[model samples]
Target chain A: AQTIHQWPVAEIKAVGSPLSLGCTIKGKSSPNLYWYWQATGGTLQQLFYSITVGQVESVVQLNLSASRPKDDQFILSTEKLLLSHSGFYLCAWSTREVFFGKGTRLTVV
Target chain B: GDKVKQSPSALSLQEGTNSALRCNFSIAATTVQWFLQNPRGSLMNLFYLVPGTKENGRLKSAFDSKESYSTLHIRDAQLEDSGTYFCAAEASSGSWQLIFGSGTQLTVMP
Candidate 1:
């Protein structure tokens, strides 16, 4: 069975600090990967998705970027964190169906 | 303008009862997917619905492209079924950038 993994169940950072979040998929090959953000007590929002290595599409114009450094690895990063970046970040992989990771709760102070 | 909207926003149900959650879309949706977000903050993919109905165990979901809507029916709701349900749609343009509804919070009480 395929499984998705994400790191740092929760995070706290100051504004203007660099940020990085990571995701890895096991038992899947070249599946589409995505990054979704849900604000505190808010709705789910698609942030980015990638179909193949070195390619990603942006859904929302937040100050965030995603990269597919490897086939099974998708990364989300920012040069400097913003207060608005505080939220629940989810990493997912999809072929026929999308499966989400445990997610990382980011609290930017 | 809301491209996708979920109805009721919240619901309460007793165990062994039946209930339905709905999502109405303004965009020309080509595909719909339903998800359940538990209190633990994990989002589980429930169903990836097309323009028809699908059944799995005690749950069923239907998506209507012509009607621009989708419904997830819970049969004999259980206590473990309490959570927020969300519906996301992809336009015929083929962009998998799913636009999600606001979500409906369901509570199944014993």
Candidate 2:
């Protein structure tokens, strides 16, 4: 069975602080990875997606970037965080079906 | 323009009753997926379809590409079933991006 693990379950940072979130998928190789953001009680927004290592596509520009450094590793990062960047961030992998990770809760102070 | 729209933005159901949620797409979708967001904010995959129907326990879902619509039916609703339901579609344009709906919030009352 495949499993996804996300790091730093929750984080609280200052507006100008830099942020980095990570996700790893085990038991699956060469899967499509995606990053989704959702505000409290808001719709889920697709941020970025990568079909393979070293290639990532931006679905929506939220001032965030993603990289698939490895077949089973995806990273979401930003040079700086904004107040509007506070939300729930989810990492997902897809093959025939999509599987979402537990997600990271970010709060910008 | 709301390419993907879910009807009945919110619903309240009594335990043991049945309810159905629907998603209509304005884009040419080739595949559909259903997910449930629990109260703790965990999203779980319920079904993934390619123009067909699938059933799992008390949940059943159907997708029709021709109609650009999908439906999820829940039987014997339980309190644990209370959560937000979301439907997403992969457009036929060859992009792997899945367009998601606003979601339907379901509250199952005892």
Among all candidates shown, the one with the greatest TM-score: 2
Q: Could you give candidate 2's per-residue lDDT for residues B1-110 as a string of tens digits?
A: 99999987999999999999999999999999999999778998999999999999999999999888999999999999999999999987458788899999999999
Q: Cα RMSD to native, each candidate?
A: 1.2, 1.0
Each prediction's TM-score against the native? 0.96, 0.97
User: lDDT tens string, model 1, A1-109?
Assistant: 9989998899999999999999999999999999999987789899999999999999889999999999999999999999999999999988756689999999999
lDDT of 2: 0.93
Q: What is the per-residue lDDT of model 1 for residues B1-110, given as tens digits with 9 covering 90 to 100?
A: 89998987999999999989899999999889999999879988899977999999889999999999999999999999999999999876457678889999999988
Chain B TM-score of all predictions, in order? 0.96, 0.96
List candidate 1 stretches off by more than 4 Å: none
lDDT of 1: 0.91
The TM-score of the first chain in every model comes to: 0.98, 0.98
